[model samples]
Target: MKILVGIDTGVNTGFAVAVDEGKGGDLIQVISLTITQAMARVIELCELYSKSQVYLYIEDPRKRTWFTGGREKAQGVGSVKRDAQIWENWCKENKIKYTLVHPKDNCTKYKSDTFKKVTGWMGRTNEHARDAAMLVHRRSVRA
Candidate 1:
């Protein structure tokens, strides 16, 4: 069996794990972490799943359009970008094979209403965690 690890990189990082079952994937766990803790957590998971090949899928932070009236949003976006660069560098250094999953490619269900409809109004523990799970779910054979 192989494990698929999905990540949502943002202010509050999200990570989820799923391993392939004979029929599809088995959703396992989800957690939220700080930017500083993200890389270490992934490495920990990789070590834990040593018997299974691990593939990571991280959501590429889409370009956020900042209001022309305020620079705050721009600064926030800058921070997110820096964090992403750190993740990329860590992955390269560790030789971890990974994929970047774009927001659009997953589906148009990110919005609350759309997500509610698709998930039967299921409330998630954390939005970032939900995003990570959804990303992993997208690559599931049953998806």
Candidate 2:
């Protein structure tokens, strides 16, 4: 068995999981939740899929940027780096293998563009979740 996990982190983080059950790529599950909730979900997934070899595809946080009051925001308001660090620590503690994937590797030239396309398709709600799921789909097909 093989399992792939994709994650999009920010103010609204999203996570998607795909499984290869000897039948090619199949979307096993998807979720849009808070960063804290997403972390919990990841832990749950690790346990649920422990029997299989898992590979994580996480959107690199360094590429994300945000603005506030007409100027770039430096802290708070969902820091991708912070989120990534948390996830990284969790992965280390749990012995989960993870890979950092840039948004361009998946699609969407820019972070904002990625967010727009994802949110636009998902109706501006749960965009991160939808994007995360789409990333999984994209990678699975490519594989």
Candidate 3:
């Protein structure tokens, strides 16, 4: 079994957990929560699946050079980048393997219907969760 986790770190963080059992069996779970809550969930899941091959992927906000949005957007971007850094540090400290993925690499932004169609995830989800889910969706697709 392979456990794949994807995170969109920001003020409203997103967490997606995908479990892949060989032979074309898989499960996906996604949710939007506060940054702290999301991190706790990630840690819990990692611990629970300690024996399995777990891979964590977080959106790297540090790749952005500039932002056009005003103060609010800039503040949000700053928060995201900071959170991403913290997540990276946490992964290193815990010796958990992880990957910092660029936002452009996963195509996070998707409409509700399109997201459901693309990922075959029917659960209710917010923008952040959708983005996070998309990060791991690629892994499931490949599997």
Candidate 4:
């Protein structure tokens, strides 16, 4: 079994997890919540799926968010970076093979836009979870 995780952050953070069950990847879970909860959930997932290969796909943390006719907002970028760093360290310590995939690499568009499209009405809410599932599906096909 293999798993892919996707994350998108804005007004709210969205997380999606996908699991590969031989044939392909399927959406196993979806969540949109505060950064703290997101991190906690990631940890939980890691433990739950300890036997599976876990890959995390997150939007580039370095990208700046420029508002229309206004200055850029760096509000959540720091938190994203911090969360990523924590996850990275955890993976290393636990010997979990993980990969950080840029959103543009998968969607061929801006991370925000790609996230919006993938999430639809749900918007940023729980979108990451859906995105994670999609990433897993794609990975499974490629594998």
Candidate 5:
């Protein structure tokens, strides 16, 4: 089994988990969670999927430049960057393999309908989840 976890870190972080079994198609789960909850969920998933080959991919907010944005936007960017760092440190501590993907590496903003059509996934999802899922879009193996 191969488990891929994608995270879009911020106040309302997006967390997505896709599990692939050689015999069957991928099973994907997407949810919007608080930053703290995202961390806890990641840890829990690591424990539950201990036997699987798990990889984490986080959207790196540091890659973008925030210029002249309002205070709120600036704060949000700072918080997201901070959360990404936390994720990186946790992965390093646990010896988990992880990758930091640039925000613009792919099309992160996808409407729900478009996301469903693209991934061939009928599950419900929010913008954050869509962004996170797009990070591992290549690995999604649908039936």
Candidate 6:
């Protein structure tokens, strides 16, 4: 059994875990968390599925394109990178086999529809989870 975990990190981080049960089988679980709760939630998920071979894929922080606001706004909005850094460090410390996935090479660049047809996921809500699942799908090149 192989377990692949995908994460779309940001202020509202998204995660998707895909379990391969052989012969085109996929069991996916999804979650969304605030920046503060992100690390703990991921750790909890890891523990629950610890028995299987696991790989964690997290979306790298995107560079801010337009910070039109003043210094205060810039400082406040910079939480995205800061959170990614925190999670990256935390993941490394935990000794989980992890990969930092860039948005350009994966679903973030194209759109959520990239994996909709292929994955066993339903509905259009919670794209964070959807992107996470897609990351798992493209783990080979992106990871």
Q: Which portions of model 1 miss their true places by more than 4 Å?
A: 62-70, 108-124, 138-143
TM-score of each: 0.75, 0.69, 0.88, 0.60, 0.85, 0.69
lDDT values of the candidates? 0.68, 0.66, 0.81, 0.57, 0.79, 0.64
Q: What are the clashing pairs of model 3?
A: none
Pairs in clash, predicted candidate 1 = none
Off by over 4 Å in 2: 22-24, 63-78, 108-125, 138-143
| Model 6 lDDT per residue over 1-143, tens place | 66777777766677766665554326367667675575665667667778236677777755435556898777755766676677778777887777776666575543545555566456553766666667776344222
- Quote the positional error of residue 127 for candidate 5 in Å: 0.9
The RMSD of every model to the true structure, in order and in angstroms, is 3.9, 5.1, 2.6, 5.0, 3.5, 4.2
lDDT of 4 by residue, 13-53 (tens): 55667766676556656666776676677777778876356
Greater-TM-score candidate between 1 and 2: 1
Q: Which regions of candidate 4 fall more than 4 Å away from where they truly are?
A: 9-11, 63-72, 76-79, 108-133, 141-143
Model 1 lDDT tens row, 90-114: 7788888677766666553366666
Candidate 3: count of backbone clashes, pairs at least 3 residues apart or interchain: 0
How accurate locally is residue 142 in candidate 6, as Cα lDDT from 0 to 100? 22
Task: Using lDDT, rank the candidates from best to worst.
Answer: 3, 5, 1, 2, 6, 4
Q: For candidate 2, what is the lDDT?
A: 0.66
For candidate 3, lDDT tens digit of each residue in 33-142? 88888778777877788823677889998986767889988888888999999999988887877889987788878989999888888889999998888777757424
lDDT of 2 at 103: 65
> What is the Cα-based lDDT of residue 72 in candidate 2?
50
Clash counts for the predictions, in order: 0, 0, 0, 7, 0, 0
